[model samples]
Target: MFVSQPQYEFPFPPDLEQPGSQHWRMVELTLHAPWFLLTVEIFDAEMLDCSMSRTICIAWDYDLAEVLRGLDPETVLGIVCMMPAWASPNGQWSSKEVREVWMCSSPAGQSVLLVDPAGEEFDCGLVPEHVEPLKKDLVLRVAPAKPRRRPHSRRKTPPTGNRRSRRASARKSEA
Candidate 1:
């Protein structure tokens, strides 16, 4: 038997320039095994332009606060990912590689800063026009705890009245 997974919809911020033009919005965030993926959907008016995905290794166990910390004005943001060692003519060499990923920044307000492996900044044109909504969506995914609810019982309550009296009444009614 096959089972379907639940699909969750998150609230997205309004479009950047009115409603009937081009804009970018974050559509989904999902964990695919060892990688955590953030997907951005681009829209040209009502039509979908394309989708872009950015991923980070799940081993890092990054949380919302840790992600937002990269935006701190006083701190220099640098995220490095370690790679497997390779064999060379001389000997084995371990490589410390940095992949292109999204980094947060707060120059005016929260925004995404895209940096290449060479430490150069470039615009992917996929970053949402506004980022606060994206941040809120990330927080919801990281800590999606809902208020606890009491479990309901399926068994019906016992008939109200003395057991003997109820039996006697039932007998009389049958007669």
Candidate 2:
């Protein structure tokens, strides 16, 4: 029951750096204005690694912004998950990743994500040399809305014919 990995590279490629292959299950992402709900089926091993690894740690996907506020280490390594809701009105979204530090379970043993504002741009080389970037946990590329249902969803029958004409049609049916 052992595995071989390089101290877990943060922002690593899902196809490779993962403890195992990236098992992105069908997670349901519901964006309810101001907040979002994520039902992710993250691999159990990944979750265990979050707390078991002595040299590696997995942070929530909302702390990347805060890290910017603090003094970044000259040389550090880690992976960060991006928020899926930081999209702008123009439809442009942040390509940079986000990391969050949450207090889960009384003592804090979880790494769930929280929404964050995308006010800064990520340097081509954001993380330290040791760190790498992974694909978004839930990358939502929202394009412009296409043509909707014909006449819109609120289709209404035009007011055709006069009131007496309508009565004649009803009488014909009665006969």
Candidate 3:
């Protein structure tokens, strides 16, 4: 797959919900990527080598990370998902695994557990006190090779008036 888009909803068990609560939040993952990275192993906390794609390890929540760094690692939640690959009607492409990863990657509010790979997956049932702030805008930018060019190239030539400018300048200088 060229890129992957994963939208995940963390499954909450029966015990996790409050008495009146409708559901418990397991996790949510939404990803829009260009191409798939081909690996899943982790060498550093900053990146991951997945079987089908290379992904940088990053936490998108700056507010959440700071809070996590101070609390107990075990108290935090971990979301781990794995999927295959798929294609769409438009030229856009993606992987099923990427979608699984998205569940672990997306968090809308604060107090979330997110990182590259501190030690193990969230399944370890442990969390750090405070995670590093997310503004920490952990983003990956790729250059588009063939940006959709305009059907009609519009060559904008500067308004031609150099001679007029010279005359104006000369008149001002004389004055």
Give all TM-scores, in the order shown. 0.19, 0.19, 0.17
Best by lDDT: 1
Tens-digit lDDT string for candidate 3 (52-162): 222333323332334324433322223222221322335444322211111123133233322233332231122234344422221211111122233355845534575
What's the lDDT for all of these models? 0.30, 0.28, 0.28
Question: What C-alpha RMSD separates each model from the true structure?
Answer: 24.2, 24.5, 23.7
lDDT of 2 by residue, 1-175 (tens): 1123444434546565547643332333343122122211122565653321112222322333233224222112223333334443445433333222221222323222332234333322123233223222322211222332332336455446752211000000111
Ten residues in sequence with the least summed lDDT for candidate 3:
166-175
| Arranged by TM-score, best first | 1, 2, 3
User: Model 1: how far is 74 from its true place, Å?
Assistant: 3.3
The TM-score of candidate 3 is 0.17
lDDT at residue 17 of model 2 (Cα atoms): 59
| lDDT (Cα, tens digit) per residue for candidate 1, span 24-127 | 23333232211222221223556553323223333332432255344322121223332222222344333222223344443334433433346655332334
* lDDT of model 3 at position 132: 41
